[model samples]
Target: MNRVLRAALFALVVAYLIAPLLVVAGVSLNERQVLFFPPQGLSLRWYGAAFTDPSWYRPAINSLLVATFAALIAVSIALPLSYVVWRYRVRYAKAVMAMGLAPFALPPVITALGALALWIVLQSYGRPYTVVLSHGAFLTTLPLATLTVGLQNLNPQLVEAARTMGATGSAVFRTIVFPFVRPYLIAGFVFAFVLSLNEYIIAYMTVGFTFETLPVKIFASLRYGYSPVMAAISVLFFAFAVVVFAAVGRLGDLPRLLGADETD
Candidate 1:
């Protein structure tokens, strides 16, 4: 009876989470000009329209570019920091990591507000890179987590063994530490990229009209009207996320990187 109840609950939760996306995807195929839930009839016209529209295409391209850069930046910063935290037990490392994670932990409005203020102070408000860095900083939490988990799972005896053989810290890392943590680094990068791809508040607040990302564009379109093209854009974003997860799943034990206990 308990097992049956658990399966039922799981099904309920999954349905709750997935029903909205399925609705949007269904609506994207609507044949009528109006956005409707039942989707008057099935058609692929909006998918073509979404791809052909410059407003949609331009923002999506910008989002992809910025997210790619943000992921790179986040992983580069998080890998070393997480390694030092895990390997050396560096003083105040937790505090420092906490600071780095603050942007993600705080309300999005607060982080967006802060990034906006910093850009204003530096007079760099209009640059696309501002959004990249903001997303990078905000996403540091992901790589930091996965890398820390990866480092924790590494054998300390391996480090000792390498040191006993005269391996320098840098040598030990490159040869021993990096090989183990590389998958987590990549997982973190994928996480950062996907998060940045979907982000809007900081992107909108920092660059305003100077740069636009897909989320911002969709939001603007909603301000005036709604269309099946927006649904198509959403479905495309959903498909991209699915592909990213499929790739990440192939790259590593996705559950372990997410802090699941491998011992289990």
Candidate 2:
């Protein structure tokens, strides 16, 4: 395609992705109580309402808590697991890796159902920590994959050099390996955090309608008719995600982390 045509196509794709979010943000600023396009007037009433409302605040807090814990847990698990896979290349490496990633590859509903069933069998009910554990189970795979890719691109000779300098295994890892892979680690953590924050089905199935996350709150709000508060929530979520990912991109070659060709 010609440069002009390619540019136009890119712009079109951008518009298609951004349109709904822009509309939601615009409606959030509308002075009217109900959501409407081309808002009657601009105001921050809905934003204020969202913050002030316990109903919204509660769910937002729950989502934040879950996402934070999930990110930490996923990174912790993925780090060692990925290190083993990359360094050892064990006989069952492929099988182990596939099992780790199976949850993400399977249909979400099926995974949720399976998780729910497991939770029931294990008698873990109404436990927020268990919910975090369940979310982390699937989320860890993304970070593992991301870190593995980063490791693949690294020079193994560096680790050997550190060892030759009398560095112990832990010392070499901490001093040499960690710095090079830190960017990928951050990228993976953010990926897991964002995915967990936006995820609904597994969370809904595991926690049920009794507990609410941001997405679940939004879904519930739909039953009571569209409100400007929902739009405000949507805007907040979108802005937060964009700012986070943009920060990550600024710190690292984000396209490479996403498995995109750096030359392109």
Candidate 3:
């Protein structure tokens, strides 16, 4: 009886979570230009427009570029930070890591405001690269966390053995540390990339006028009127996230990468 009740509760929770997405999916299939659920008629024209139309396509390309570079920057910062904290055990490393995590810890609106002020002070507001850099800085915590977990799970004996065999610092990392942490590194990149792809406020604040990402563009379109294309884009993004996470799980020991301990 207890197991049956638990299963029923789980199904209810899943349905509650998925209900909104299902509504959006239905709206995206509407034949009319206006947003309406339980469509007047069913069609996929909005999805086609999202791909072929320059307005939609361009912002999507911009989002892809920003997300790619932002993920790279995040991983670059996290890799060294995690390595230094783990290997050297520097006294200030924890403080530095905390600083790295501050952006994510704070409300996103706060981070967006800060990024806005930063670009304005530098007189670099509206530049295309500003969004990428701001996003990279804000999203650093994800990769930092994943990499830290990977390093914690690493066996110190391996590093000691490599050093005793006369391996240089670079050699030791390349042969031992990096291999152990590579999965975590990839997971971290994926986390940062997907979040960056969907991020809105920072992109809008940093480069709203000059460079538009997909999310920014979607909001920009709202002033004119609601379009089913926005719904279509939302569904497409949801699909993308689902596919990326599924791939990560399929290709890796996802639970272990995410810090789950090995179970016999």
In terms of lDDT, which candidate is strongest? 3
Sort by TM-score, best first: what order? 3, 1, 2
lDDT of 3 by residue, 173-257 (tens): 9989998899899999999999999999999999994788999999888876788888899999999999999999999888888
Q: List the residue pairs that clash in candidate 3.
A: none
Candidate 3, lDDT over the whole model: 0.92
- Ranked by lDDT from best down, the candidates are 3, 1, 2
lDDT of 1 by residue, 1-264 (tens): 699999999999999989999999989999987888888989999999887889888998999999999999888889878877787767898888897777767889999999999999999997999999988888988888888889889999999999999999999999999998899888888889999999989999998668989899889889988889999989998898999899888867888888898856
Candidate 3 stretches with Cα past 4 Å from truth are none
Q: What's model 2's lDDT at 13?
A: 100
lDDT of 2 by residue, 98-126 (tens): 87788878888888888789888988855
TM agreement with the true structure for every prediction? 0.96, 0.94, 0.96
> Which consecutive 10 residues in model 2 have the weakest lDDT in total?
122-131
Q: Relative to the unseen true structure, what is the C-alpha lDDT of residue 35 in candidate 1, on a scale of 0 to 100?
A: 84
* Predicted candidate 2, C-alpha RMSD: 1.7
